[model samples]
Target: MEIPIYIFYALLSAIFAALVAIFGKIGLEGIDSTLATTIRAFIMFVFLLLVSAFQGKLKGGITSRQFAFIVLSGVAGALSWLFYFLALKTGTVKAVVAIDRTSVVFAIAFAWLLLGEEVTLRAFIGALLIVIGAILVSLK
Candidate 1:
């Protein structure tokens, strides 16, 4: 829940993501990207379920509203994956990831405006650098 924890998580996500790109590129050498994605999704689903059970968080207490939101989240995830796969087909994984990671900018802006979070100079600087880096990467 802390900001630093989020940053650590993001860094770890980036590391895993690099591995994903390399592995996916190799895995899809002959198979279609869609098939590869489906396989990965299934594995991820199983792992997430196991993690949820391990955390004792799946006590069959989900409300209908929670179920709705969970389904919506899954829908959004699928849509995101569709676009990501399409991007991977045409662009280097690095470029796609660079652009995708700019979601941090949106998160910062949203927190500042909607959540009333403090807009620290460090956060502003980091967001600026990230956007500029993404632009540089996108320029070819």
Candidate 2:
């Protein structure tokens, strides 16, 4: 059976996310968390722009609604990163990341409530397990 292309991308995302914590922790020493986050965001913006330009994918126009939602998402992402860096500054990366990953549970609930997506019993159970695991890992 062929796995979906998205699965590969998701795996890459996970790998890169782990790297972010390690690298960001090292980079945050003697730096403000907000400043570090801004620097990271700037780097991401430039890289994304270069990739989009290289791929000729920058010409598309977006609707106002699309623009609004995208901006909202960016803001939410920035806030998440800001708090994550703050947490990492004072906490162990393992515990911080484990707790941060509980966002998946929030995502599941939000998708079901806001997007009207179906939540299977199995998914709920899995989310519950994640919560338990995160708690276990977070405890010293």
Q: Which candidate achieves the best TM-score against the true structure? A: 2
Clashing pairs in 1: none
What is the C-alpha lDDT profile of model 2 across 73-93, one tens digit per residue? 999999999999999999999
Error of 1 at 115 (Å): 3.9
Q: Give the Cα error of residue 27 in candidate 1, in Å.
A: 2.3
Clashing pairs in 2: none
Candidate 1 CA-lDDT value: 0.82
* Highest lDDT model number: 2
- The C-alpha TM-scores of every prediction are 0.75, 0.98
True-structure RMSD, every candidate:
3.3, 0.6
| Model 2 segments more than 4 A misplaced | none
| Residue 42 alpha-carbon offset, candidate 2, angstroms | 0.6
